[model samples]
Target: MRTAKDRLRHTILFELLGLVTVTPLAALILNKDMGRIGALAVAISLLAMATNYVFNLAFDHALVRMGRPVNVRPPWMRALHAVLFEATLMLITLPIVAWWLNMSLWQALATDVGFALFYLAYAYVYNWAYDRVFPMPSAVRIKAADR
Candidate 1:
């Protein structure tokens, strides 16, 4: 299991990097004002950040229970992780984005789907990089194995 601080750091960095990468692209693709897109992006980022912490903790625990090493997921598992995270997040964020942007549900869903696809790729790469950079401490891994 990761410490609260580690989780916090992961969430913060994930959102910060995502916001930087996605904001301008979303603005350009969506053809909306940057400020409007930025605000929506920030709202989505904040929600995703909170959801990420909780979801990752649960995911890690599930992996440990299943006798998988949390830090060394298989590629298939990594794909599942990204898809599951975005699927859940899209559910929570779609309505919020529609309300904030005053768009119809269909429009919101389309927009959210676009974000989801980007995040699916982003999450896969980000987690792969993050694991390499900040591996699970050996002590934590050993303890998880003991379970």
Candidate 2:
């Protein structure tokens, strides 16, 4: 498990890097103004940062209870979770994204999917690197075991 401060760092770094990389690409691919794309990206990133905290806390708690924590998530489970999360996010942001870009709902949906794909990959890589760089504290391991 990560400390709150560490998690905040992770969220900030992840979103910052993502915004730098994705905003331009999104603008080009979606043929939208950079300001629109960048604004949307910032809003989405902030929301995702909040969601990241909640989701990871919940997942860690569940894993501790399960006892077999910290390994590769099953492919099916990963896919399911990713799809559900993306769909929920799409619902929340579609109207905003659409209105911002002056696009239709379907256009927004497609754009959202593109962004989701980028994030899905970014998440996997970020987490892998984060674990390597800042692993769970031994205290957390001990706590997990005691639970």
Assess every candidate by TM-score.
0.91, 0.81
Model 2 poorest 10 in a row by lDDT: 138-147
For 1-147, candidate 2 gives per-residue lDDT tens digits of: 667898888778878998899989988997878997888889888887788777766766776678645444555655555566566667778888888778899988888888888877777676668667877665546454455
| Residue range 44-88, candidate 1, lDDT tens digits | 899999999989989988887887766667899999999999999
Q: List the residue pairs that clash in candidate 2.
A: none
Instruction: For model 1, state the Cα shift of residue 5 in Å.
Output: 1.1
Off by over 4 Å in 1: 139-147
For candidate 1, the per-residue lDDT at 110 reads 96
TM-score computed on alpha carbons, candidate 1: 0.91
The alpha-carbon lDDT assigned to residue 12 of candidate 1 equals 95
At residue 49, give the lDDT of candidate 1.
Answer: 90
Residue 143 displacement (Å), model 1: 7.0
